[model samples]
Structure formats: structure tokens, C-alpha cells
Target: MSTERAREGLYSRVQQFHAEQMQALDSGRFEEYAETFTEDGEFRHSPGRPPARTRAGIAKELTAFHQERFAGEAVQRRHWFNMLNVQEQADGTVHATFYVLALLTRPGERVPEIAPSCLVRDVLVEEDGRLLTRSRRVEHDHVPEA
Candidate 1:
């Protein structure tokens, strides 16, 4: 394959990877979602909070947060990623940036509630021929109150 063609293919693969990863997360597959990252991957959400380090840590944090957030309700969160920009680095790592919309729906609700949109940046690396996230940072468009 030509260089340009190979890059395009890589971009498509990266987008597919994000889709699968987000689906796993929305489906409440915590472990599976965490597995999308490298073993020692880092995940940062918003500002002023410490980043979750390592796959186990990421899974633990997500499980607790999700459980508490939807405690007694059967709420579903649908994540939509758009305007993805994927770039391959000379060092062989892939950088991806995209905007994500989180839609929340509850039982008997006709319309899903939209959460704050976020911009996500990710660094992906190939491990054992599988693409895995090396790091991720999510910045919400809404400003949090103190």
C-alpha cells in the first residue's frame, strides 16, 4: 500500500477503535472499556482532578462513579463521537481528537437529556498488534461551579 493509503487506513481503524471502546463503556462493560487502554494507561477528566492511572484504576473509578450516578434508576448513556481527527506520529503513536456528546435517557422518557459536550484527546499505541490508548484527556464545554 502507498504511504497515503496506509495513513487513511490507519485513520479508519482508529475511528473504529474509538467506536468500539465507547460502546463498551456505554454498555457498562467497565473491564472491557478499561481493556481498550494500555495496562498503565492514564485517563483524565476535566480539570483539577487527578488522572486515573492504570487499567485497574480506571475500571475501579468508572464502576463506582457509574453505579452511584444511576443508583436507583435504569438510565442509559449514549456517547456520540464526532469530527474525529487522527494523526500518526513519527514515533508510531496515533493522536486522536474528537468531540463527544453524551445523551442520557431514563425509563418512560420520550427525549434523552443531553449532558455537557466534551472534547476528548487520546494517544494510542500499538501493543502486540492491537491498538490501545496510552492516554486520554476529556474537557467538558460546561464550566463547573465551585
Candidate 2:
């Protein structure tokens, strides 16, 4: 295959991976979402806050966060990604960046509200023929990062 074709293939794979991962999170499958990350994966939800390190730590935090975010509420959060840019790094890792929109839908609401739009950067690696996120950083568009 030509280099361009190979690159497109990788991009497609990354896009599919993100869709599945986000769906897991949206469905309250925190463990399944965390499993997409590497064992020592790091996730930084914001620029100021420290990253949630490790797969187990990520899962724990997300579980607590989801519970708190929707406490006594019937709201669901869905993640949408767009304008994905994927690059094959020299070290064999894939770098993917995209805009993420967090939409919140209430029990009786017909339309979902946009919570925040963010720019996410991720470093992905393949281990045992499986793609896993090594690190991720999220920058909210409305918030000024210091």
C-alpha cells in the first residue's frame, strides 16, 4: 500500500476507536471506557487540574464524576468529535487531535445542550495489536488555560 493509503487507514481506525470509547462513556460503562487506555495511561480533563493517572485511576475518577454529575438527575452526556487530525509519530505512536463537544440531554428534553466544546490531543500506541491511548489532554474552548 502507498504511504497515503496507509495513513488514511490509520486515521479511519483512530476515528472508529474514539467513537467506541466515547459511546462506552455515554452509556455509563466507565470500566469499558478506561479499558481503551493503556495500563499507565494519563488523562487530563483540564489544563489546570492534574491528570488522572493509570487505567484504574481513570476508571475510578470517571465513575465518581458521573455519579456526582448526574446525582438525582436523569441527564445523559454524549461526546462528539470532529475535524480529527491523525499523525504517525516517529516513535511508532499515533497522535490524534480533534474538537470535542459535550452534549447534555435531560429526561424530557428534546434537544441536547452543549456543555462545552474542547480541543483534545491524544497519544495512542499499539500493544499486542490493540490500540490504546497513552495520554490525553482536553482544553475547553471557553476557559482560558493558564
Give the top-scoring candidate (lDDT).
Answer: 2
lDDT of 1 by residue, 14-66 (tens): 87898899899999999999999999999986566679989999999898788
For TM-score, the strongest prediction is 2
Rate residue 104 of model 1 by lDDT: 97
Q: Which sections of candidate 1 miss by over 4 Å?
A: 1-8, 144-146
- Tell me the whole-model lDDT of each prediction, alpha carbons only: 0.89, 0.90
Q: Lowest summed lDDT over 10 consecutive residues: which window, candidate 1? A: 1-10
Q: Candidate 2's residue-wise lDDT over 54-136, tens digit each? A: 98999998978777778888788889999999999999999999999999999889999996989999999999977899999
Flag regions of model 2 displaced more than 4 Å: 1-8
**TM-score for each of the candidates:** 0.89, 0.91
Error of 1 at 96 (Å): 0.3
